[model samples]
Target: MADGTVKRQIAAKVRQAFAPLRLEVVDDSERHRGHSGYREGGESHFRLTVVSDVFSGKRRVERHRLVNSVLAEELAGPVHALNITALAPEEDSA
Candidate 1:
């Protein structure tokens, strides 16, 4: 898939999987330009900030696991790195 398509797919998958109160997906690959694993082709690194009720009472590791599980196919294939910031709705500052 093209970079834009991949990004949209990631966003849509996250929204569908978590039903978050808030979700933001940022393309951070530009900052890593020329670095190892950096894709000159397009953005590959991402930062995902998500707040969801599903994260309530869940430990950090568990929350990461849940997100990873939801994006398993993408992670295993297209997405090279994901910087995930997960929070419960009540814990969200925004």
Candidate 2:
């Protein structure tokens, strides 16, 4: 699939899986243009900021593991780097 399409799919999957109060998936490949591992079509690097009730009691390591599990296939293939900022709903407001 195309890079943007893959990114959108990843976003949709995360939204569905977490049902977060806020979820932002940014494609950060553009900023790395001409750099190693930078793809011309994008979707190489991503920053995911997700705030959800599901993360309320989870530890930081667990939260990241959950997200990593959700995108396991992608991480093994197309997704180069992922910066995850997971927050509980209560933490989100503060």
Candidate 3:
């Protein structure tokens, strides 16, 4: 996969799986420049902020797990690290 492709895949998969009211998938690979798992073209790391009804009653770990499962292929492939902030629609003021 190309650099931008993984980012698109993450966003699309999350949208399909949760239909989140709000979703932001940021590519954080640049910040990990000389660190481990840093790839040449980026898309190796990400930060996800998602607000959806699907997370209404779920715990932090549960929410992460749901997202992890949805992006299992990416996680096992190009994506090295994922920083997730999942919240219910009501929990997000922004």
Pairs with backbone N, CA or C atoms under 3 Å apart (clashes), candidate 3: none
* Model 3 regions more than 4 Å off: 1-3
* TM-score top scorer: 3
For each candidate, the alpha-carbon lDDT, in order, equals 0.85, 0.86, 0.93
Model 2: lowest-lDDT 10 consecutive positions = 1-10
Q: Give the TM-score of each candidate.
A: 0.91, 0.89, 0.95
Q: For this target, which candidate reaches the highest lDDT against the unseen true structure?
A: 3
Which window of ten consecutive residues has the lowest lDDT sum in model 1? 35-44
Clashing pairs in 2: none
Q: Which stretches of candidate 1 lie over 4 Å from their true place?
A: 1-3
lDDT for model 3, please: 0.93
Candidate 2 lDDT by residue in tens digits, 36-83: 777778888888999988898999999999999998988888778889
On residues 11-80, what C-alpha lDDT tens digit does candidate 1 reach at each position? 8998998998999988887887887667776557888999999999999999999999998887887678
